[model samples]
Target: MEVLERLFNVALVVATLRTTAPILLVALGGSFTTKAGIFNIGLEGQMLVGAFFAVIGTIFTGSPWIGVLCGVAAALVLAFVFALLVVTFKANEVVVGLALNILAGGMTVSLLKAIFGTRGSIFGHGLVGLPVLRLPNARDLGWFGQMISGYTPLVYVAFILVPVLILFYNRSRLGLYIRVVGEKPEAAEALGISIARIRYVSSLLCGLLAGLAGAHLSLGYTTMFTENMSSGRGFMAVAILIFSNGDPLKILLGCLLFGFSDALSLRLQTFGISSYLVLAVPYLVALIALFALSYRARPRIIQETLASMGRALSVKPNAATDAEKAVTRG
Candidate 1:
């Protein structure tokens, strides 16, 4: 029983932190774009670009930090393209997002084939994943200390960033504009705000963070990159964003839940569990979290839907047409 207890404890703490890092990174990205009234469905694609660049950079530069920078830069460039298509050109956001993902996947594969003469995978002369930096005095404090130590810089960055974000959103003029654009675009437009500009910046910021998350995967967590390695973590990040009720503290909590599930899967793999079931832990936990989020979000969603429906039904035909026109512009 004592042995089982220790094993479970290890799984809980390690898995939680492991899973939290990725989701937290993506959630930060999601937060920026959503706050600017743009739904970024291309986070997965941005992450892919980041991962590809990170691996290539590490191979060439022989340094993990350079790899991380390359990854971030690549994702940032893609983000601008996404903004141009969706925000500046007024293209269908969903369609643009889907296309961006396809573009990233196709581009990465083509590059892999062209440069390495293989589409399966590639590795360089140097191994360049990020190092694990453990907290000082971690071992001396026993189990709790061990649990909190050995996180990557990105993990610490995520936690350290909350206050900065809160202040950015609350105290800055830019924050006010972002809120204006998201909450009431017309009001922002009336005040001479450029909605497109705000959205472009937001998308760029989101891309930057998503890239960091990708870099973390390639360098921080693993020393290698695999095709489609991001899997569906981008989408999972979206679920976490919703589950946290837009609260930073809650976001951390949500991230921990995911991290724990992933960690548990690892421990299970070390034991006797089938590989298939162990791999399922991350997605399964995300699904459960989303379900819980839906329960909490349902009332607000229903209210908004009903109110919109009522307004439509009660409006004069001309007014209803105008409303539709306004939605199109927005």
Candidate 2:
């Protein structure tokens, strides 16, 4: 009973971190695209493709680490496709992104069935999930061990990326160019910043990170890949990006919120609950956060609206007077 108590308490924290892992990575990826003036709704598809590739790679190479690399590379290709269509062909980004997501879902399902000869599922005789790093004699360290040292490699890597992205976004010249391009493409072009090149790079990097997020799910977190394994994580990332409003650090926190709810849902499942309800936890949190964010932004929006209305109303009298005088003269 003592052991059970400890495990339950500790599991929640671990689960929280686990939940945050994918969100953190994907949110950062979405940040990259949004910073470049692109709304990448394809993160879910990118993640799913990455997850599928990682599973296949793990099956072939028998190494999760190498599988992760392969997964990221696959995601990179998908990202490139998105950039090509939207940037080069001048395709509608919204349509292309949605289509890409559907394509990814279909492609993964097709490949899984074709390769594994399974329509809905694929499982190995035995599969090793991501390596978990634990502190030696961790119980001796008390809560400190639970707090700091016990986590998966991908979780640590995901957290490490937070500060790294912060530095890149704030301190780098390329970052400046990205911001400028997103804000004003004409201005960026005048400054000799290649908008297309910047967008392409950002898109590629976003896809790469989203792939990493997916790899975390397949190679590190689970044994196999199911259809649409990303399961709206990409969409959640989109909501997180909007809530964070381009702040990377805050975005990381937003991911954590989603992760916590995910952990809770899982814990509840250990009892007796509908799998569908368990799945809804993180998404429900995202929905609530989005609503709160919109509510907060409402005041600012109304202020802007009022100011615009005032300008239009104030302009009308003079314009009308000018027209009347012109009529009299005529």
Considering every candidate listed, which one attains the maximal lDDT? 2
RMSD for all candidates, in order, please: 6.8, 2.6
Q: How many clashes show up in model 2? A: 0
Q: Which numbered prediction scores highest in TM-score against the true structure?
A: 2
Residue pairs in collision within model 2: none
Candidate 2 regions with alpha-carbon error over 4 angstroms: 1-8, 125-127
Question: Model 1, stretches more than 4 Å misplaced?
Answer: 2-6, 243-247, 298-330
Each model's TM-score? 0.85, 0.92
Q: Model 1, residue 266: what's the lDDT?
A: 78
Global lDDT of each candidate = 0.81, 0.85
For candidate 2, write residues 1-330 as lDDT tens digits.
Answer: 964574468668877887789878888988889999998888888998989888777778788887888889999999999999999999998899999999998998889878878877666834446788986888788876777676778889889988988898889998888888998999998999999999999999899899999999876767777778787888888888877766788998898888889888888777677999988887788888988988999999999999999999999999999999999999
RMSD of 2: 2.6
